[model samples]
Target: MPAVDPRLLRYAKATRVFLALSVLIGAGQAVAILAQAWLLATIITDAFLHGAGLDDLSGQLALLAIALAGRALLAWVAEVIAHHASAAVKSELRMRLLHQVVRLGPRWLTGERSGELTTLATRGIDALDDYFARYLPQLVLVCFVPLIVAGRMFAADWLSATIVLVTLPLIPLFMILVGLTTKQLMARQWASLQLLAHHFLDVLSGLGTLKSFGRSRVQVATVEKLAAKQRKATLASLRIAFLSSLVLELLATLSVALVAVSVGLRLVDGRLDLQTALLVLILAPEAYLPLRLLGAHYHASAEGLGAAEQVFTVLDREIPATGTALLKANRTIELEHVMVASPDRDSPALDGLCLTIPPGRVTGVVGPSGSGKSTLLAVLLGFTRPDAGQVVVDGIDLATADLDDWRSQIAWLGQDPMLFAGTVFENIRLGRPAAAEFAVRRAAGAARVDVPLEQVIGERGNGLSAGQRRRVALARALLLDAPLLLLDEPTEGVDPDTEGELLNTLPAAFAGRTVVLVTHRPALLGLCDQVVELAPAAVAV
Candidate 1:
């Protein structure tokens, strides 16, 4: 619901460049074609009709060859420019989409599915390739090439040009009419893909749970049903695309035949000169050729347009308020009547609750389930906003500073510590890319993640034990060396031994940093310098 960002209009640049190249190539192609007809007419009317023989024919053949080669070379050049330009545009678009997502931050992604997001980022953006490569490029040819060819036709003989122009609009007009149906089909196809992506990610994430409950077969059957629906939608879209192409081709073919017929009649009637009639007949098809190509590719581009519309929706979302002021010092964080609400605002979670924890101290937030312990940390990290009052640091309102700059002053371990598909070293190093090897090893030692750094974490850290994943996540936070550290239940799923070690090494691991931790565990509560409970909102969630 935010105002559309002007930055997204950058997609237009790629389209413009594509169209420009198309005009150049299309004109070059039209010239070669017109020359071919003129040369043929000269050979037929002058040489063949007169006493000229083999020698003259040989000279004309060489001229024709030169024209043919020129057209071929220009066509090849056009293709290269199109492909390279398309690739650059595709790369830039993907990077922009990713940057937009990151700027929007975790608040948006948490409610969305991973597979659907992946599909949007990967398959969705890929659809735009043909929009740039084929449709826009050929559309340029359709418009400009025809104009050039038609002008040459009128100069040669206005009657022939009139016949061709009368039928020319038939192709594009029919294409547009059929395109309405194709657009609807493409929309259905996109919806099917989104549903398929959501279903697959849900199934994969819950596979362990499904297997434990002996419900894997049910999920498999559900997937089969979804896949069948997707297949149906895909076929429907393709069928429409093919049918539309057929209609456009038919219209173009009819137009070309009409021009050929008129030229032939004029030649037979002796009303038109022989050479001019031959030229008109030959050049007529060239005028409509690019239109045919554009019509077909327009169907291909429809899917991309639909996908882009969906992507634009994300970019258009109002980036809800986040902190702007930098934390003045490392010693303290304060919240005054900070209330965290759902995006829907149907149920507010944390009420007008207030809290303060000093620097160099460990704090614990404990609450019954549905209490806003997690939301408190979220607001502090600027992932969510307080509905009523302000969250402040050293008298600077969190809402007044640049959010990303404010967040950099703190290292946070969320309830779910994200681990990519890489080695443990890379995962921990993600927090502090410039940290030296020795510094990294020491942090790992403090967090007790002593496993070999080269070991793979598997998909989502499945290769490691729960305690090991916890320790590795802790190592990432420690390696950051941030001024303020926020730990959201560092030991919730960890074992007692790992928990005891984390507790024992707590002071040294987090020495001199302001630490605010969220925990329901009694053992973790004892380690904090203070404990605060975020009371539930007046109305239950």
Candidate 2:
């Protein structure tokens, strides 16, 4: 990320407003700094050298109080704005990221980890609080304060001003050098955190299976290793940050001391007035303070900058163009030399394959394990786009159709169906939320779901067996009563009796629909009007 990524300003309107406000606040703070310093110098010099009474210095002291109050007020306002701006920007980025993920579709997601993405959207984005609340305000001050302070010092004493100018650049120069190392360390720390999140989520998801296989301890050890790696990376980053902060502080302290020495020597020799020397001494440290603070806060924000970079990487991915035309009715579906590439495989999943399915008929697709059976269903269901050729409905190309409108006519059941935590009726009603109770029960009956409608299930339907979960998913799909239905191994992982029961329900369940069933069972193929077989290397009849 650059000092200020243009994408942040472009994506989050709140960032632009925050920056503009920060500039105003920085200018106010600069004025307050100069006022406070000048008032203190006048009060001290008048009281000590002129033998001024408390009454004579009272007015300067009062104005000095106002300047002090003004500076504090501005700081508070900046802090408040920084927090609000941080929240708004985070919300905007998360929403855009989610929408972009949806636009990229399931095919793009197939190559990525859900846990990594979860971490990015949640904890990763939250890290930006440091970027806004600490780093950005300091950055704004670095721009405004140093120049104003330097100019004030130059007016008071040119020799001291010259010294300040000569030494000020060194702070940022060394800061840049240290920042390079910090950036690398931060990147490593962030990568380790993401890896830990990914594997931890994977372990949790497969915990039950691991226990069944007596390998849960292996997964626990792996998670511990990942967690330890993340911890070490974090400590390493913090160590570098502390070392860099000390370096900045050392440079800033030395520069301030040098200015103090010059001002004191000039004062002793009567070359500089008491008031002028006091002002010069006071303003010297102010000139270097912002830059030193900037270096310190950069470490606090480095993780956020890294996360923003990843967010941009995902947002930059290209999605296929789509159209707005809606399908009117079930029509013959055609795949014209369709080709779909696989990121994990060198060969295309569906290579220049073409097929046609008559409307309102059950078509079975069978293939070997590595064949594109599921890929074919993904393409037909619009979750994956073909790299070559067209999927046409009647005469309209699917690529040109409004995907949402097109999907409105589709009722699909994947091999592994996801069921949210809810009553059985609620899950079935998900297909058509406005459907009446009778319609919901009818669909559930059609799919042979024996679970009580009022019975509640756990996440991913944990309360139900595999066969019951499939039936519930099938019921949800059936409830849609859509013109087209796509099922991938709907009878998979079931006993023979359960599979036969499911197969028996298919003909009536599939009635008056353009159905594409991907299964290896001969019994399922028997129910199809026409069967299409796909080879490992090609599509065949």
Candidate 1 matches the true fold with a TM-score of: 0.92
Model 1, 90-208: lDDT tens digits are 77777877877887778778887778778888898888778766776676677678888899999999987997888888887787677777778888888888898899888887788
TM-score of each: 0.92, 0.93
Q: Write the per-residue lDDT of candidate 2 for residues 1-541, one digit (tens) a residue.
A: 8878998988888999999999999999999999999999999989999999989988988999999999999999999999999999999999999999988877788789988999999999999999999999999999869988999888878899999999999998998898889889889999999999999988887788999999999988998999999999999999999998999999999999998988888789989899998898888888998998899899999999999999989988887777888875499989999998877667889898889989999889998986899999889878888889989999889888988888889999987888999999999898799999999988888788888999999889988998899888989999999998998887776677867777777788888999998999887888899999887963333
Runs of candidate 2 exceeding 4 Å displacement? 344-347, 431-435, 499-508, 538-541
Candidate No. with top lDDT = 2
Models, CA RMSD each: 3.1, 2.6
Give candidate 2's whole-model lDDT.
0.90
Question: Top model by TM-score, which number?
Answer: 2
